[model samples]
Target: MELIESYNSISESDLLIIEEKIGYQLPVEYKLFLLQHNGGRPVLDGVRYENEHFDFVGHFYAIRGEMYHDDLLRQIEEYKDMIPKGYLPIGESPGGDVFCISLKEPTEGALFHWDHEQANYDGEPWEYNMTKLSPSLTVFLEELCVGE
Candidate 1:
């Protein structure tokens, strides 16, 4: 993906701290991505899940920043309850839906599209609201496209 207007650079320590705070190890590919581009808007922002399912990315949250809306750790804290366990909110869709990465086994490193409107407020079985987007962040980045 072609990203632009990325935030400040980050180091391994910054990622380590985030991992410690979140209590989950980030996918290696995603960590590499943060080091290269802490946060940014993708030029080819469109993503297609199937023949008719499509969405556009707004922006990726920065690892460290003064911008409240773009702060990764802050966003996680603010939405911790809403987000299902074992998933981390990594970015947002243009319409406010969340793009998350699985942190638990079997699905770790996989990316998912969380539909806010259909989210389950009740609990754990909330996996229904998440649609698998890619097997890994690496594949997800490679699949970004220009929307029509």
Candidate 2:
């Protein structure tokens, strides 16, 4: 789980691509993941290692399901000071209001998925594998112009 820089580098076009893919505009923080990625893979919390079994990239897309999510969301905001430096905070999902974040490519959406059916004390990072990418989402992202 290699913790890359915050997504401050994700381009505006790229951000839009993401929003279009997921069917929603991303919170400012989620947009960061796109930018700071710096052409490398993104990792969890702060770990980075190779996972041959999976793409590690695009592993997660469009997360769903959760419990006591509001409290966790509040906790993240309340304890923002406690969070380590370099740890970027994505935002709560509009559909389910669930906390959502994603891994950069190569880990496309890895860190967020590896562990499922359990809360990660961090909004339960989730993944949507490449194979599972929704046709609509694929079309949306594919068609949307990153505008270079």
Candidate 3:
């Protein structure tokens, strides 16, 4: 994961605050990643999804930021109604698709892609939309290839 731009590493207190605000304990690996790289674009990034290469992961959002565009906490609140409850936005694709993690029990910490076009307002996010990207954020990063 070659970061194009990164923010300052956050302290443990910040992480705790975020967990409290989000109402769920973040996955250990993801919390560590955020501590190292608060937010940034990944260079030459591509991940395999259903046998197809998706190079659309443009940016990972910061926990909170002066720049409204990079504020993950705000983004999560903004998209709360649009996405299923307990799902939080962690990153975005170049085409504006959202990448999230399910906070619901039994499926907590699972990575998912929330496709706008395929969304169903009345149904659960995982029903006919929201593709599972990886079992965990750690695996997702590990599988992301630094493209040529």
Candidate 4:
């Protein structure tokens, strides 16, 4: 995946380090993937960063995206089954108090989640589900700096 930069701030070497940790070469094409698919939030310059880490309705990220394996989807399912009803099934980071997300049903989409009454931003709409997802997300994220 090609990386979108916030100003020429991040170097190839820095991305390489991230790649080394993730063990998958980020295809050059994926930079657009991060921008279009991930997020569009700007930093100091007009540049923006889209992390695969935390993207919940609230909270700032200590780390972005998760490093996980293929099995995590199943794990999320198992975790979902454990949800106590009424409350959302959320994943917590071992690092600190972070934004948590809900366990989505298979029919939902991977949008940035927000409660119905909460404020909305001018971005992609989110849903309250992720159950019908492909498995690579877990592995793709597991190599990144995510925690939960």
Reference-based lDDT, residue 33, model 1: 88
Which stretches of model 2 miss by more than 4 angstroms?
1-10, 38-99, 102-148
lDDT of 2 by residue, 11-127 (tens): 577556545654555545444433544223234212122312322232222222123332223334443443332222333212222222323334233113222223334552333
lDDT of 3 by residue, 1-148 (tens): 6787877779889989988987878777778889989978887577678868854788998866635787788888777777887777888887778888877777788888888777776655544567888888878887787542
Off by over 4 Å in 1: 122-125
Where's the lowest-lDDT run of ten residues in candidate 4? 40-49
Candidate 3: segments with Cα more than 4 A from true spot? 121-126, 146-148
Each candidate's TM vs. the true structure?
Answer: 0.92, 0.27, 0.86, 0.24
Tens digits of lDDT, candidate 1, 40-100: 9999998888855489889998887536788999888877888788888889988999999
* Model 2, CA-based lDDT: 0.31
- Roughly what TM-score does model 2 have, to 2 decimal places? 0.27
lDDT for 98 (candidate 2): 22
> How high is the lDDT of residue 131 in model 4?
26
What C-alpha RMSD separates each model from the true structure? 1.6, 14.9, 2.3, 14.1
Clashes of each: 0, 23, 0, 20
Winner by lDDT: 1
Order of quality (lDDT): 1, 3, 2, 4
